[model samples]
Target: MSVDNRRVDASPSPAAPPPPDPGAAYAPGPARPPGPASRLRRFATPVGILAGVVGAFGYVATFDPNEPGHYPVCPLLGLTGVYCPGCGGLRSAYAFAHGDIGTAFGANAVAVVGYFLFAAVWVLWMVRAGRGKPLRIGLAPVYWWGIGALLLIFSVVRNLPFGSALAP
Candidate 1:
């Protein structure tokens, strides 16, 4: 066969690379992320929130809210005999502490809902902590408004004779 000089390649071999330099490597080393403890510090916000919740629950449990002088009086109650949104929270907590389900529900249906809410939030916090995700309260304004409206309705319904069973 006759030689074809035009087909000769000018580029280096595809399989071979340039020799490594005697100096520092140009390739970056893997970036090691922070460990759990360090990551926890970075996530101080969620930690603070969780601690506050635990402390609040502990305080409520240790000092029964039903007992007078443990907590400040509800301003709304002093102004009117009517049941405010938070009127029966203390009694409901006390009932919950003593395992009196009927009393708990009677003290405040809304508070019973609060108890479940607290439990769900606590569970989520624990789960997110395990996964190294921050506990974020991303509720929409509309959802918060819905909660407020629900409480207002709860307050009104509990005060009425029809919803007397809801009263403490």
Candidate 2:
């Protein structure tokens, strides 16, 4: 009996694709133009957000947060006498709704800034939706940290004597 010395290949066929590159960025394929219904659907989220904000502002405007029993006091302020970042935000909103921008800022400067920031972002979102593009706010970690630091500073300052101007 003669012994055969030929080896058989068990590896994948040469036609098979190579593994994808993990570091490669994803590129979307060509997109079709949005129709009327598609445009309406895209705009829905921003519109809904606007409606909710308007409703909330309307309610705050109607009920004065400065008056007792109108709105609940901030638990942190009520308990420990420390003003959180959100303290007096309701009064700020209420003043803003009534077109009292100066009073609104006096109530909570941070909240006023946030309100304007939200409005700007909402406008951008609407514009992107109209153009059939997704609104992507890809803020870096540094930006998030900066925002946290700002809120912390605001909260700390508002509670101090020097920051009495910032307090409600």
Candidate 3:
């Protein structure tokens, strides 16, 4: 032959796969049905979180935040004499735990609203976990910004004389 110009392909064909072993006795099947233990396992995280929250509320309820030298003062309030959104959060929690709803709102209306929001979210999380679905709180950036603006407004209002009722 004068010249050989043909190119040879090196790659394996896509349709080809390694042959299965005939000697194997067992093959993987579909997933097994969830048992009582499995269902309980799914709820472990939500229950643990609830336990932690309950413990924290219990501690706050036991040790009054309104009393002097009980809890740490908010650094922003201590330094600038200006209230932050979370300034009275502990006190609010204490009041809420004690079933003093009005006092809780008086301490921090935003914090009281936040407590209820957290409870709602926690319930949703628990329900989704029970259903084997992931909890999705996909808030838009605008919503987050709006929340921040609201907190800023709350902080500013609580500091003003007219909004003194919002202060702790």
- Tens-place lDDT per residue, model 1, 1-168, is 987678777997787666888796687768899666655564565568778866766667788877778888778777787878788787787777668878888888788888888779877876777677767989899999999899889889988999888777
Model 2 lDDT per residue over 60-128, tens place: 999999889977888899899999999889999999999999999999999999999999999999999
Per-model lDDT: 0.78, 0.92, 0.90
Q: Give the higher-TM-score candidate: 1 or 2.
A: 2
Over 4 Å off, model 3: 1-37
Q: What TM-scores do the predictions have? A: 0.64, 0.78, 0.77
lDDT of 3 by residue, 1-168 (tens): 578789888986688667888998666887799655577877998899999999999999999987899988889888988899998899899999999999999999998998899899999999998888878999999999999999999989989999999999
Ordered from best to worst TM-score, the candidate numbers read: 2, 3, 1
Cα lDDT, model 3, residue 110: 95
TM-score of 2: 0.78
Screening candidate 1 with a backbone cut-off below 3 angstroms (N, C-alpha, C), the clashing residue pairs are: none
- Residue 137 in model 3: lDDT: 93
- Number of colliding residue pairs in each model: 0, 0, 0
Which stretches in model 1 have alpha-carbon errors above 4 Å?
Answer: 1-72
Candidate 1 global TM-score: 0.64
Candidate number of the best TM-score: 2
